[model samples]
Target: MLKILKYLKKSSISVVAIVLLLMVQALCDISLPDYTSKIVNIGIQQGGIENAVPEVIKEDDLKKLMIFIDANKQSQVKDYYHLIKYKDTESDSYKKNIDKYPALKNENLYVLKDIDKDELKDLNELLSKSEMALLTIENNKNQDNKIKESILKSFPIELSVKMKDKSLIEIMEYLPKEKTNAIKKEIMKKIEKMPDSIIEQSAIIYVNKEYKSIGIDMDRLQNKSILKSGTQMIAIAILSMFVTIIVTFLAAKVAAKLGKTLRTDVYEKVMSFSNEEMKKYSTASLITRSTNDIQQIQVMMVMILRFIFYAPMMAVMGIFKVVNTNVSMTWIIGVAVLFIVFLLSILFTFVMPKFKLVQKLVDRLNLVSREIITGIMPIRAFSNQEYEEKRFEEANRNLTKVNIFVNRIMSFMMPSMILVMNLIGILIVYKGTYSIDSGTMQVGDMMAFIQYTMQIIMSFLVIAMMSVMIPRASVSASRICEIIETNPTIKDSLDIKTFNPDKKGVVEFKNVSFKYPDAEEEVLSDISFIANPGETTAFIGSTGSGKSTLVNLIPRFFDATKGQILVDGTDIRDVKQFELREKIGYVPQKGILFTGTIASNLRYGNRNATDDEIKEAADIAQASEFINSKPEGVEFKIAQGGTNVSGGQKQRLSIARAIAKNPEIYIFDDSFSALDLKTDAALRKELKRKTSESTVLIVAQRISTILHAEQIIVLDEGKIIGKGTHEELLKTCEIYKQIALSQLSKEELGNE
Candidate 1:
């Protein structure tokens, strides 16, 4: 919540607007009970009602007031000022919904007359100009406006032909037409025989007619007790509503604001870690912490702001009213509340531990679901679909069972509170009736006390509900905090001198070594090499030979744990990461892409890259063939991860992304694994020709792939046991010779 407060401070303007809206709504809600009390006790009881509203109020003014109250009951309805004032609600496209159904106007169903004339005119005009009717007709027939109008109008016509849901068919079936008038006349006589006072009271309460309008003497004004009580209810209702609104709005925002702040902090902290530290925690865990944990905190904050807050206020106010209203029956309300609290506490203590367990299980279930979706193809091929399905089902069932149990326990509070409250009510009424008969209490005073007693219990019930969620939210908050506090092991050193881009792309590793965090063995050991400008250096080894790891060091994606790497004769440790990576272009083995146009992905490497430059890069990477084949050409859309494209195509596109940047150094980490031999050779030939001025580093498994390299380093495990050209390596290096022998005979090797 504290973190959320920080965010609220930044977005304080929205918070304030929301608070103001809620307050208005709360005030309106509060006023309703008061209005009810006023009409019942003040106007109806007296022979002459005294209270008056604005003179401009119409005969049905009470109904209008009620309607307004109902509308104001919704907090969102009260938020209209925010939307209207700022124009930041739904966009114009969504708001102008009437534009899509022009024929709705043609039937005279959607009338032009409205309370707001400007609104009516604007609505009518919007309906007329929009081609919505024609647009929705399956794209073909919809364009034929005449057919569209006929189709749309026929439905309402079919319904209007008969009495629909408003049918009075049953009464028409049972009653004879001639007898209906006779029956109604007799009913009217019975209604007329009702007491005159009842008639006057019902009229003032339900019909909004004043005493003068009804021509009745208003003696109801003298019963000031009911009138005062009712008026106080209205005022209190209004006050409660306003305060609740302000509190709730601020509360909801606190959750959202906290989530955003906490998430941002977690991201910033994770980013701060050096590459070495990043590898320690899984990406999935970090994502869960930021999204799920923060979300939990957010949800809790909203509940706390809205419901939890109301409980205590109600308890306090209810107690005051209940006790002060009827001093003798005070113990009843207090004892009932105490019982509720004790029951709630016992329930919470038991449920709190379960809620924590439930959250952990939720996290696990989410993790498994994500994994299954991501590896759906593998699961199918391996025939583990049933296994995964059963696994998920079991997890789901357990989660459901636990939640149901928790809810079962939680659901107890409300009903129990209401029942206990009712029992207390019975006793109060029994005792109050005696007081009233003995001339010690008034009927209205006893009624007010009962109302306050109910409120006190209700407040506790609200607290009970909030308590169930609090434990879970607290756990989530702690999880989020842990993530936010984690410092990255690899980060930019403060005060480090950044790399200068003007220097040639010369890279060298001096006795470089690396070990995975907390691992037993080194992945790269005592490796020393250099690649100068205008040269192609390659590393070749079987899988797990640290080929990719070696290239990863160049961009500082993973720093060497034990040695120094220099770029342009300056140690990379002295350079800022942004300056170091800007000069390097890398294409990884797996081609990762986003949901966007090809143009967008291409421009990600260099935001300012021109269309011509993109095309050239595409041509250089052997991707132009497929890209031009697309209907939109470079504008062709790529689904997330390039799932829509073929493996070979995705790889080429990834290469093109790198080429578009035209950086000083190019690192291809087995980037051509998906390409066909013909395209691979062509791509390599093009790269060699076009990128002669830039340093090139390639990691490969195929010997033929790196045969043309100026320097070939043969690695086994982490150690660079051999280094030379293809000919030199074949003659001197044993591992290289064995690898070369596996591919060719002695004569073929000699001939090469």
Candidate 2:
């Protein structure tokens, strides 16, 4: 997975944008809870607008507020100046004040909150200190509550409190009676400037008038808060949606590009592989690696972009919000997250090995399927359809059984996650209810806690989901890497030279030998031969005599294990494979053809071949008669592998494709085996004249095919048994004589 992540560097800007958007979205989500708590705690719990302020503000408290207003020149308080002057609180002044300054009433109401916070704590302390000073001045003799009240009300509350206990007692005793009375009279004069109370029938009457004059409009406040919060939440949701779309699009684009690049890389690498490498990884496994394995990595790339980045962020932010709201309940999120991790760990450990095995099984299944599709006719002809079906079913069932086991384990993931979430929700509510009753939490706060907990759980759920796929994707990445990292055993040699010899179409093998990779013995050994320009060289031998293997070395399909093969005097290994193969037109024994028109298959050899050149080549290979007989002629369509055509026709077209290239050398590896004896004889007659200027090498089982060749090399067990024309071989070579006698009578040998 990490290997694939390197591809994401191209989209770094999108990644950063997605991250920023996620953060904004998360913060907005966290903000809604505070609004919920506020609406519940302030709007509904506190009664409507009428009861938003305290009823009984002391008379002295009002005067002190007025004095502070005067000193500060506060413009916000200027509208309430009438209250300072409205001493007759019992008259129409209360009603008139509400009618004159309705806006000021709401301001004054909420300002009480600030006033209560700023002045209330110190007010109680001031009252307590004043009582102590009064008692000390009276020498602990003031049992009369009224007299105590008079002394307390005589001076400024702050000033009286400031006088030390020793000073107050000394003032009462050391001062003369007249001086003491004069001091008391002066203090009383200062107190009289702001009257103790207005002309109300009682203190309760005074308190009622004040509350009616100034208090909050709670309905207005709640509506405004709800509107603001709702708008914010909607905006956040829209932004989050846009971010998700962008992230998804970018992730898909990256995955597709990664898959395309990986496929291209694998294909180009495979194209460079020698037969040794091709054998190392079978055709079916390579197909799986290129297609199925790449798909796995592509899917994982999307999940990494969309979930891997998002889950951790959400989990961390959710945990932060949870701890911020109620630290005690944080353990609930932790326990849930831990449980999810444990569950995922158990499943991943068991299923990951299976995921790797599944790919191999898929390869096996593909190999069987391909074999059945390619060889269906043979299976039917041999009456082994049921056997083939059973073989395929066995492979299919093995893959199916493993898939079911893995899926059965994975199916529990979603339900188990939901179960954990529900159980945690119940646990949170159970604990939160007690906290709410104790006044430490509120209903809205509990609801927000639940949301945060869900977010945390969802984060872990994302991780759990990813855990299931990451192992599989990781296995796929490694498989793809295995193909990509493989170095072809056969590659172009350094200091490569061009092969533009004067004697074109010359091929030579000097002491050549080859062994299959990991084989105990060589398939071909110490073979030496040369096919000169404008001459035919053919090999005839029994089965497993390295007939096809020796010819394969000419094109470097598999490099010679010992010694060297040369084309036009240049070592084939030292020339680039593409350059070397370009001069040689090879037709495999099976006569493979791609899906296209006859022209397209022929053009595969030379895209620039003219109509006349195509017709001439087909004529030389005895393919023009059948090709012209068709309704479309040269434009006739051919099915893949030429399955729609007869075996003889397919082989003729294959020869014609090679002939159209007009290459310097032609290799026919049993290419004429499919044709009838007459068609074969006629085709060879035309081929000899057409390729008279090229080096022609043929591997054939029939004595008739190579009897006319200028040089026929007979091989047996990787060693050359004979090297001469047919008549000379029949006279000198035992193995060649045996092969000739089996295919032709003594009279036919005499005619040759």
Q: Point to the candidate with the largest TM-score.
A: 2
lDDT of 2 by residue, 687-706 (tens): 98998899899999999999
Task: TM-score each candidate.
Answer: 0.71, 0.81
Report, for every candidate in turn, its global Cα lDDT versus the true structure.
0.67, 0.76
Runs of candidate 2 with Cα error greater than 4 angstroms are 10-217
Q: What is the model-wide C-alpha lDDT for candidate 1? A: 0.67
The candidate maximizing lDDT is 2
In model 2, state the lDDT of residue 647: 85
For model 2, what is the error of residue 378's alpha carbon versus the real structure, in angstroms, after optimal superposition? 1.9
Q: Provide the lowest-lDDT 10-residue window in model 1.
A: 128-137
